[model samples]
Target: MTWMVTGGAGYIGSHVVRAFGQVGIPAVVLDDLSSGHREFVPEEVPFVQGSILDTDLVTAALREHGVTGVVHLAGFKYAGVSVQRPLHTYEQNVTGTAHLLEAMQSAGVTRMVFSSSAAVYGTPDVDLVTEDTATAPESPYGESKLIGEWLLRDQARATELHHTSLRYFNVVGSGTPELADTSPHNLFPLVLDALAEGRTPRINGDDYATPDGTCVRDYVHVADLATSHVAAARALSEGRELQRVYNLGSGDGVSVREIMTAMAQGTGIAFEPEVAPRRPGDPDRIVASGEAAARDLDWVMRHTLTEMVTSAWQARQAR
Candidate 1:
């Protein structure tokens, strides 16, 4: 089966593309090069330069390639920026997804693996979030993703398209030898950039309710997350029931300070973080339980925090 990976040139998307290719799964990539790098996609795969928002381009590609499954990973994903530009975020994350869904339906593509986010759950009062938790997104980016899942739900009810929306939390780490993070907004890359310049990485807050007085989050390796997509596709192909949503995470919370310490240790870089006040809409803690994914998708996280930092640092150095 030929799989079409949207945003296949991005950090996590590129890893998914590589993962599918490594397994000898016939895959093609469609990216607009907005946040994705063309060089990230392998030369072996058929790469199409286009946006999911473009219905004509998307439909044509799906039909031409006879794509049976889609792994949707293209979207705007910055919490802070989403607050500043709600319309732009919604247009890219929601409208873009709607367009992709329509194109899929038109082209008779029946299965999909959407790249959802844990931000959809917002700041849950509970520490370990499950798929059953209430979704109360605090940022527009999160809200947009929530809407993306809603689109899938509505579409599945109306058609034969089966989708698995995997809500991801803090997707990090590297997969390929060239694992440079092109997104300038992510925490890992931001911290790495600061350290590379011998500058202090600024911590938004260090007086939260969590240990070390910092907010905590679950950081998962990109490769492991990509593997979950493959499993999701397999389960969908096995005639698995209707639309499903699962949380893919490490099942452990790591504080901001802890991550910084780990990075310093991993890269042998001694740099302090400049603590600042908490940013707006910032959650004190967000960690996901991968029980649903583990049980349903048979997923497991293989990398530790040290491994995440070390791999990311090495990737940054190579770039």
Candidate 2:
């Protein structure tokens, strides 16, 4: 069965598309290329250029590609920018998800795998976040993602929809050097870009409650994340019941300072990161246990931190 990947031209989405191909699954890509690079999507894949907000376009693409399932990854993904542009965030994420669901129903696509965010947890009081953790989204982007999950749940309850949402933070690394994270907002790209430009990488915040006085975040390899997406799709296609939500995160987290150290070591760039004010809506630490995902999907940390940095650096230099 052919699976359609929304935002497949994006860094993470491109890897997901390739993962599907690795398993011999026919895949189609739907992307607006607003932030995604057309080159990120392979030449062999069917590429549909459009926004998910366009219900007609999405429906047409789904039908044209004979798509039986979708790995939905399209949305306004910048959490910091979403704080400033809440309306735009809601329009693209909340409204856009609604439109996508409508299109899926119209095209008779019953399976969906939503790529969600750990931001839905906001600043959890606990050390480790789980599926049972309370969702208290602080930013508009996070709120929109939570709403997207809700939309899936409500639709599944009312229709023949079978879906699951995978929440993750800081997806880094590369399946191939050709596919790189081009986002200016993500930490990896920001640091890599600064170093590539021969400038000092800036740490957004210091003096946090953490031991290193820097924001701590959970990070996973992009390829590993993509593998779980495929696993989720396979489970859904096989009519296997899956949890409503799963956190694809490492139980242990690394501080920004620690990440900078790793970057220096991995890239062989010895320079201290400049201290900068924290971005709005950023939490001090966000780590989660991926036990559920590991139990259901074939989730695992296949790459070490060094590997993550070197792969990202290689890809960044390629771009």
Candidate 3:
């Protein structure tokens, strides 16, 4: 079945599109290119360059592509930045999602897989986050995602729509050298950029209560994440039952210091990272259990920390 992938020209979205292609599914892309690169989209896929905020454009794209389903990934994604740009975040995420859902209804498309974030948990006190974990989002970005899920749920009750949201932690690495995480705020890009520019990467606060006294976070390879998205879409298309949400996370976590070491090893930049004060609101550790996702969405952490770093570094260098 053909599907429409919002933000399909983006790093993560492009990988998801590629995964769909590998599984012999035709996919169309809708992206405004606000943060995505047009080059990331494959030549064979139909690309509609427009924002999801435009109901007419979204509806036309869905109709034109004969879209049977959607993978919603377009939105304002930076958590820290969303705090300062709350209105912009809501407009892009919350409002945009509403518009897309409306367009889907207009086009008679009833299946979707929403690309959500782990930020919805907002520094959970638990060592392993489960699907039942309390959602206390601390940022507008996270709040908007939760609200998007709510919108989907409310719409599902009123219509024929079937959907699932995939919440993921730190997404790193590359499925191919042609595509890389280019976000200035992401750890992999920031560290790779620093090393490429001959600057030492700095660790924020090495005095936490965790092992190595540094913050630990769940990191998953982007390819694995993309595969799960495809699985979720397929499940919905096949009328398989799915929970409202699933966390795509590594059962264990990797510390920031371990990341620094991996970066050095991967890039062969042997300089030690400088220690810096912790950023405000930074949690010491946050990890999630992917048992639910693993069972339903084909979730798995297929890459090691070293492999993640190496793949990311190689992609950055290629870029």
Using lDDT as the measure, the top candidate is 3
TM-score of 3: 0.99
Tens-digit lDDT string for candidate 1 (1-319) = 8899999988988998888877778889999998888889888999999888999999999999989999999999887788999999999999999999999999999999999999889889987898889999989998999999999999989999899899988888898659678678889999998888888888889888887899888888988998889888777877886337899977788899998898889889887888999987677888888987887776898887888888999899989
lDDT per residue (tens digit) for residues 1-319 in model 3: 8999999999899999999999999999999999999999999999999999999999998998899999999999999999999999999999999999999999999999998999999989999998899999999999999999999999999999999999988999999999999997999999999999999899999999898999999999999999999999999998999999999989899999999998989988898999999999999899999999999999888889989999998899999
Which ten-residue region of model 1 has the weakest summed lDDT?
234-243
Clashes of each: 0, 0, 0
Question: Against the true structure, candidate 3 has what lDDT?
Answer: 0.95
Q: Kindly report the root-mean-square deviation of model 3 from the true structure over all alpha carbons.
A: 0.6
Q: Model 2 Cα displacement at 236 (Å)?
A: 0.4
Off by over 4 Å in 2: none
- The model with the greater lDDT, 1 or 2, is 2
Query: Candidate 2, overall lDDT?
Result: 0.94
Ten consecutive residues with minimal summed lDDT in candidate 2? 276-285
Candidate 1: misplaced stretches above 4 Å? none
TM-score of 2: 0.98
lDDT on C-alpha atoms for all candidate structures: 0.88, 0.94, 0.95
TM-scores of the candidates are 0.97, 0.98, 0.99
| TM-score, candidate number 1 | 0.97
lDDT of 2 by residue, 10-97 (tens): 9889999999999999999999999898998889999999999999999998999899999999989998889889999999999999
